[model samples]
Structure formats: structure tokens, C-alpha cells
Target: MSRGTSEAFFDVVEWAAEQPWSSGKVGLLGISYYAGSQWRVAARKPRGLSAIVPWEGMSDYYRDRCRHGGILSNSFIKFWWDRQVITNQYGRPGRAARNWGPDTVEGDLSEEELAKNRQDQNIDNAANHFRDDPYYASKEYDMADIEVPLLSVGNWGGILLHLRGNVEGFVNAGSEFKYLRMITGRHDLPFYYSEEVEVQRSFLDAFLKGDDRVGWSVKGKVPPVDLVLRKGDVGFNDAQAEKAYPRRTENEWPIARTKWTNFYLTPDKKLTRLEPLHTPPKKLSYRALGTLEDPSLIQFTTAPFEEETEITGNVVAHLNVSVSADATGPTPSDIDLFVTLRHISPEGKEVFYTGTAGDPVPLTKGWLRVSLRKTNPDHPKHRPYLPWREYLSTDRLPVIPGEVYGVDVEVWPTQVVVEKGGKLVFEVASGDTQGSGIFLHNSPEDRSEEKLRGQNHIVFGPKFSNYVTLPVIPPKYGA
Candidate 1:
């Protein structure tokens, strides 16, 4: 994308509205980039923009697309920028030949001129680490400013990127008739599903054409949330099986009746509801800067569930952690924490779900740069289940050796139903583990040896017990 993208779209919307055949009420629709652009343009409050369906699009550019927990998501950014953005750039030669689009109407720009015009997103993202920095702050817009009717369809498998923004956008947008719809399956296929397409048409018809068949035009007539439950492992990337996973309606995101349960991490590697007490503090160490190829991590497993249990919504892990420098390498300065939630079946099989790229994935993942761990408890978006951090340059905390820091890791929201005898595993790793797919945080500049390479430890005891708070949803009355 281009700077002033929303403005450009707004101009086109205005022009289309004035056309002879136009209805004067335009609706925005699409997935991914098309979906992402809607948020920005809707916030601009474009004339004739009556409604929007931002299906599987990210709302926050900096937090959602470029960085994950203040660590640069370099891999995906590079891939997308190179394959999608640059190849489709205006005035780029050979586009028509490559089936990318027609060659520039104004003829192609010289390679030198093209280089001068475009900013390399990969390089810029790695260089800018804080949201408060100009590079990110310049792209910021207030979600609350958007007053259009919205249907934000988020993908359960979009754990690495668009999922957070969809949830956050729906929660923050100022639209009086805003609704959230959650879905599953591959990112590209779900949007084109016949049932999903019907939803898009119904919403647009309700707002744009005054066809209020679904009662969408009437306030409070329809439930504000529609959720697709990931009940069982239908196997990853199986569209047909995932479609049978069942659906439900709720009045709000996070489901108001959610039972926020804490599963304590014990020294014995068990995850229990009861907090451990009166035990000597024990440290579990893992080599820092571990990669997917050579993972160094610790796991805490819950006892098999005697009955069916449903885990849904956002998750947070409160850990008592510290780090020490290795004998020979440069002294460590910061820590990057990668946490994954995995589902295990009664027969001891790990259930995997479809990821953003159709790869096998765990339940969900979360990350945090320890130095940027200071959270804003007073922020309006802050919740007991979710901590909101500004990721500002001024919020940096010292990460001295031997100093233990109690930090909260915000695991991406997830949904999984553990069957009888099924288990849930909480994994804490030094770097990107399985299920990260192409969205790895391996930028050398961002995770330098001098800053993050060391021995990372999770201290466990009564005073320093670590626990993952899971949003356990119980059966609703009269279901």
C-alpha cells in the first residue's frame, strides 16, 4: 500500500456515487488487502461509503502487519512486500508479461527511479522497533472514528497476523451497528464460500440498498456477534470438515459469561488449577535465541480432562522470569518470549489446525519483548484477560542480569474443545517455534546476539509461580 490510501479510495467512491447508474450508497468488500484497506478508508468517513465488510483484513498496520509484540515480523512482511506490493506497483515494467496487471500506462520508470520512489518495508520495519517511532506512529488512525456499519469477519487460523486486528477493530470502531463474525479454514477460501458470500450480500443489502431482510438495519434486532466454534480437530486445511464445526451467537466479544480460569505451571511440569505453595523456587533454563530448527523450550501439561471442556477467547500467561549471560558471548540485554498453546487428544495425538498459510498449527501463539513489557493497566482497552501495551520508546524497562521480572504474555485468542482425556500444553520458547509458519521473528538486527543471546529461566515457586489464564467457556443455560 500507498500512503493516503484511504483518501484515494474516498475520491473514487465519491466519483462512483455521482455516476448516472449509481445508487449513491457504496459498500466496501474484499479479503486481505482489500479488507485491510476498508478500515482505513472507513475511518476517513468517505462520502457514499454506506457500509463495509472487512473480511480477514488487519486493522492496525504497525502492530498487526509489521510487528508482533514489538518484535519485527520480517519474514511475512518481506514476502508480502516483494510478491504482492512491488510486483503490482504502478509504472513497474513487465507486469502484463508476468500476468500481474497491465504494464504502466505512463510507461515504466527506470530501476533507479523505482528504487528512489519505494521504501523497502523489510528494512524500514526492522529499523523501527517502537510504535511511538515516526515510522509507525505516522500510520496510526483512531478506530473509534469509524462510524460506518461494519462486519469484521476474523479467521481463527489467522493467528500470526489479521486475527488480532479484526478483534481489536470490532471492539474499538465507533460504528453503532458494528458486528463481529469469526470463521475458520484457509484465508483465501473462506471469503469465497457460498455461505460467507451470502452473509456479505445480506449485510450490504441491509445497509446499502435498504433491504432489511436480516433485521440488520434495526438496532439491536440481530445479535452483535456470530462465532464459528473450533470444536474438534477436523484436520488442518480441510475446508469441508471445518465447515461442519458448528456456529453460535453471542452478544459480545470474549463472551460475557466466560470463566477466566488459571492453570498454574508447577515444577513437576503439571498444569493444575490449584496454585503451588511452600516449595523451593526452581529455575528451568533454556538457551536464548533458539530457532525453529533447534528449539529450546519448556512445557507444562494439564491432566486429562475427565469431561468435555471448552477453551475459547483471549489468553494471558503471567510468568516470573529472568535471564543470565553465557560465559563467552556478549552480555545479554533483553529477552524475547514465544509462547504456544497446543491441544492434545485422549489417545496422545496433538491436534493441529489450519494456519494462515494452510500449514499445520497449534491452538494459538503469543509473543513479548521483555524490555517492552511495561503495560498500561489504566488504558481503556485493558482487561484482566488482556493487557494493553502502547509499545512506546519511553516504556522500556531495564533487563539487568539476575533480576527477576514478572511479566504478562498476551496469547492470541483461541478456541478449542478438549475431549474427555484430552490435554492442553503451554509452551514457552526462546524464539519462533512450530506454527509460526512464514511469520517468523528472526531479523538479526531485531534479535541481535548482544541483546538477546543468553540463558533464559522461568522461576517457579509460591512467590514466583507462573500460570496461564485461560478463558474457559461453560455451557450456557437452556442450550
Candidate 2:
């Protein structure tokens, strides 16, 4: 089952291996789609495949790309398939500036020729396949099968496509010499930065040129991890000046001295460290299929912090909720919830980050369908970072009407420094039935247009442990 891209490239590698004057040892390297394909091809363990450097590309088709938190992400995919992939078709204009309107050094192209040149991406109606069916599964290549020396490159700003996969690849690969190198910057910024390029050169030299003294083989003990800390307050702007100074490195993934803070959600919509009141289970209900302007989302916020708190690594929100019974039109069989992390400025404005919308995109986002809330025990845990989602068909546990179910959602990994007096906020909604929508609703969980109809009841009390486990990194005051 070939993924959407070219699988024949790997065949070329095999052919090159058997050449009359070949070294019989091959290494793959590229950025974006090129980087993405390296993972898929390396999984086959083709003869002579020695190394791979997947710099900022998606490794998983289902969870990482097409669908997020079990909901179909239509907007990004549609635009990607239509604009970049489609325009760059054989006869159409390649990538162009937004204001340029697809007309650049390449001449204007005919709509007909462009149509004839375009190949079916098969993602036109991606919303229909919510789970990892044969379609998405075929596109994914298991990283665990890759046994080559790997230098998985990633950028902290690669929240949309590469961050998680890069980390996962380094952790799961069968290779004994896998290393992870991450820098802080916009998606393409690190690719051209001199320091980042120098690092890449050394890795390539050590592996491809057999210069073992330069790469991980040197001394047999350079911490397998390298990262650049982002500077300043809590905004996630990865773009940086030529000299953003203060670059440093740590030995491992779980940064030292990371204090995990669990904030409990009170019935009164407050985020507090103290436990919720000992009263009976409290509920916040919203119309099952309400419109954007309607009262649909329930938000909880913590009080202004007295000091700055730098949060990095993963943040998990465990929700204990239930859906009220209803036999109305297209009654919902499960609940689809969109969870977003936000920072409130002292003056009362949502602080936007780099990823989503330009103004103040969510610091991070998470999604989940109540029916598939179960976790896999065998899934080697990433601990406080990634919640091992059991996406298997057998592992999915259905939601019973009026039954309380616990769902764990992983907010994308991020780096932010919340200054004193700043507040953290959590917004919850059964569906994207609000102006602050993160993903377009098309999956079975989305109760939009009366599709999966049911009132969402968020229960919070002693038994209903509704809280967010945040990896809080306090300021290095003495350092």
C-alpha cells in the first residue's frame, strides 16, 4: 500500500545499492515532503539504507495530519491539497506569494490544463474516514522498524507537522544511534540558520563520510539530545532575528526541575489548585447543535499568577464528562470535545501565538471523541508528555448514554513563559460551535447541523476528576 507520494524512490535506492561502482551504503536526507518520505521508505529496511535525516515532516497520516484528536481537520488539508499541491501540478503555477495570486515567474495557466495535470489526492472527502482505516494506515510507516543511524531534525515551531513525530521517531526507532536535534524558530528558519546548518554538516560528515569522531559516535557519550531554548515571555513566535542569543543544551527530554501542576476545574468555572467543593456532581450544559453566536462553550480560568511560570513539554487535560439522553434529530452517539489552551493578558485580551490565527492563536490545542477515550497499556508511555492513545478498533470503548467517561487529551507540546499577573485559561466545547473554532467539524463526533445531537454535561466533583496536568517550568532565577 503506497502512500500518496512516490514509493518508487526507495526502489532507486535498492537499484543504486546493486550498482557496479556503488558503496552499498546509502543515506537519505531532505526537508518537508522529502523528509516525510524518508521515514516511510526507511521502514521497509531496504538493503544499503544506512541513515536518514527527516527534517520537519509529518510521520503519521492519521493522528498527525488528516485527523486531530479524532476529528477531521478539513481546512488545512483542503488548502494544502488545493493551493500548494494542486497549483504545483505539472502545468499549473508552482508556489506563489498570497498577494501574487498563483502568477509568478511561471506564466498564467489554463484551468483546463491544470485540471488535466492534477492527480486525485483521494482526500477530497477525507471527513468520511475518521479513524485510521486502510487509507491512512497505508500511508503511515512504522518508525519502530527503522534500524539505521538516524538524525531526526525538528524545530520547536513545527507544531503543525513535525514536532511530535520527530520526538517519537528518535524514541521508537530500532536504531542504537538515533539522535534528536531541535532548534527554536519558524518552520523554515532553522533550515538556513548557520548554526543549525553547521550541526547538520557535522552529522552528515560523521555518518556519510565515515567521520565517526564528529557525530554521536565521538567519545560514545555526547548526550543524545540537543535543544535551543526560546527567549522571552510566553508568546510562541518562532521567528527570530539573526542573533537571538542565549542558546543552550540539556542532556535529556524531560528537562530537569519540571514541576507538574494540576489545576482543578471548579463548578463555578475557575481553575484552582485546591480541590473542587465536596458538593454533588455539578454540570454545565449547552445546546447540542448550537450556532457560533449561541452560548455553547464553557471556559475556566486561573487567577493572575504572582510570578512568571515557563511551561514546556506536554500538557494533558483529563476530562470526566457525560452526555444527556436525547432522542432528537440525529441524536449523538458520542461527544466530540475541542480543548484549547490560552493565556490571558493582564489587560484582558487573549494572547495569540505563532501557529493558528495570526492575532493570538491558541498556545496549544487538543481534541477527543468520548467513544475512543481508552489508552493502550502496551504503548510505551512518554509519561507527562504524550498520552498513549489506543487508536485500534478493538480498543475503542463506546460511550453509554448518561454514563460518565474519562477522556485524556494531549495538548500539543509548546514553550511559553507566562509573566507575572498573566493567567492560563481552558476552554471546552462539545463541538466547534463557536467563533473561536480550531478545526472544521465533519467527523462523527461533531454534533453540528443536528448530526450527533446531545447535550454535553461536564461533571466535576470528587469522582469526576476534571483537571489539567501542566508541566510547569519555574524561572531559573539563580542560573
By TM-score, how accurate is candidate 1? 0.98
For candidate 2, list the clashing residue pairs, or say none: 234-417, 332-453, 352-360
Error of 2 at 36 (Å): 1.8
lDDT score, residue 305, model 2? 79
Candidate models: Cα lDDT each? 0.89, 0.68
Candidate 1 positional error at 268, Å: 1.7
- Listed in order, each prediction's TM-score against the native is 0.98, 0.81
- The lDDT leader among the candidates is 1
lDDT of 1 at 477: 71
Per-residue alpha-carbon lDDT of model 2 for 1-479, expressed as tens digits? 24545368778888888898877877887877778788888888888887788887767766766667666766566666766666565445544554424454557567887777665553433533544566655676667888888888766555555677777777777787888777654565567778677777777767667876554656457677666554444455535541452555555555676788898888888998877667476788765543444546788999997887777777889888887756555555777777777777777766654542222355666778777787765667636556877465665676766788887887667666676888889888765533233335544333454445777888877678789888787554553
Runs with alpha carbons beyond 4 Å of true place in candidate 1:
1-3
Candidate 1, residue 381: the lDDT equals 87
How far residue 348's Cα lies from its native spot in candidate 2, in Å, is 5.4
